[model samples]
Target: MPRRPSGINDLDLAIYGHIAEGGELTLSEISRLSGRSKGVIFRHLRKLSALGVIEVREVGGVLLASPSRSPRRVIAMGIMRAAEYPYVLGILRGLRDIYGPVRVLVYEDAWREAQDLLSGRIQLAMVPALTALVANRLGGGRVQIIGGGSGGGMGVVRGTGGSGHAVVRTSNTELCAERLGLDGPRSYFGGPGDILGALVSGKVHEGVLWEPYLSMASASGLRVEQCEIEHCCLLSANSGVADQYGKISRIAAAAISSARSADLQAYAKLVDLPVQLVESSVRGYSFHEAPDVAYLERMLDAARRALLPGSSVRDAVVA
Candidate 1:
């Protein structure tokens, strides 16, 4: 039996993009512009209209579609391993409480978030502080740090025999390994989400991952060789949205300053881990509103050593 379509598809996205690029488009116009058959286009348009992502109107017996205004204004918040970091999760929860159901874009690397931030694809991003610096340099210093979250959560773990065959997650971890002399074993690079699985599956004998993952792995019987590094994650915004700083800062403060133990149980559920593990993970990080210049420079130096191209750390930080 042919299954009924349930939600948005590429056809729907293309049609919406076409309409969003200009004035309202008729069904035929959307089909022609998007290069899809009329019947397929109609199905997608009907779905999008039903979902309220696009508007459908009739004029002169022709059905016309237009992009909804709300989606365009939606600020895209980018993150990785959101459930692991309390402050990152707090910022997200806080923003949604203020703005209501904002869109989130998940990426494996801060590098990708930096690219999207520069291209205006994401209005706000929660990235590694250095990644924000790299993007700031890329944007000619247009990136602004409204605040920061999740301090001191980085660490490295090794498998049996203490061989550091590792896949480090962030550039920060890479730097930590180099600084602390944990870089001896052959190392590969993976995103935070993949690091734990990689280690458990024996793809790598050692792994460097951040909170919740660190706790979860230890709970699952993997030995944690070391977890003592303390790097922060930053809340970054495009300079164009600087006027909204007052609101952003307020939301950040409310979330980070008011963090309570009860919050861990809820966050643990998101990552499908034990409340105890989540509680322990929270101890790995410090939540705060601002970061010092020297600390940011250390991160930038690491980013530079890790060879993140373009813009020295000095040029990247906003005054």
Candidate 2:
């Protein structure tokens, strides 16, 4: 299943890029450039036009799209829906309440989110702490950890001690395997959905997963155990938009607290999971409005010990 789409997506951006390259682009030109059908180009242009990021006009009976301002997409990717719930509430609802409608993209993993974020295609992204660090290094002082990340919520479900066939592995998930000395070969999973799929497909019996995925694993008759590594995910922003970090973090935190008390059906739908799973998954984790200085330092130390590639601490984090 795909994540919910509330704004511009990669395909839309590709179409927009064709227009931004200068001169008005006809539907056929954009479709050919983007490898999408004319109807698909038309559909995406509507939203871009409505958002004032592009202007669609009929010129001499041929419809054309012209670029205005480049679109900005705030992405929230997590191991499960619960992890992104606050950002969805805060950025989607709170941003509208304060600023206006903004594009928000949900993801289940950090791979593409990290790529888009570092390439400036993304305005902001909430991803694993390790990913943010590596991205900051890759972007060369162009990216920074803005705020609003999570701690804890990492564990193993039916994890075998160093000798099993395989266990689910992700950036944050592997922390537990490393901490608990699980030395077995790892089967990498993209996100919560992938982990679930692996379980259902019998590809792996154990998974090192986070919150909601762990809960789902438990519900599937697997035993769960908490890992002591407290580093999970963090919020990273393009340095060009550094000024908005404070406001984004504040709104996200408030929205997180607010959503905790509200009905979780919306979040469930966004993550495409049952409301019960969403509710239970969040119970075991802690969400922060700002960076946790002490834990972050500790995680950085661990990263250094693990010989991970990262920028200096000062450049990576806002703290």
Largest TM-score belongs to which candidate?
Answer: 2
The residue-by-residue lDDT of candidate 2 on 1-319, one tens digit each, is 0222466455765565567665688888888888888998899989878766678989788998886544433232222344434445455555443333344556666656777777766667667776677777877977687666666777777732323323332355555555565544455666766766666566676667776777777777777878765546666777766666687777667665564565577667666777776677766766676777677667665555333222235445896
- How well does each candidate superpose onto the true structure, as a TM-score? 0.66, 0.70
lDDT, residue 187, candidate 1:
54
Question: How many pairs of residues collide in model 2?
Answer: 1
What's the CA error at residue 200 for candidate 1, in Å? 3.1
Instruction: List candidate 1 stretches off by more than 4 Å.
Output: 1-66, 69-72, 82-84, 87-101, 161-170, 184-186, 265-277, 298-303, 308-319
Q: For this target, which candidate reaches the highest lDDT against the unseen true structure? A: 1
lDDT of 1 by residue, 35-104 (tens): 8788988888787666555788889989888876554233557765544455555676555444433455
lDDT of 1: 0.64
How many steric clashes does model 1 contain? Answer: 1
The 10 consecutive residues of candidate 2 with the worst lDDT sum are: 160-169
- Candidate 2 residue 55 Cα shift, in angstroms, is 0.8
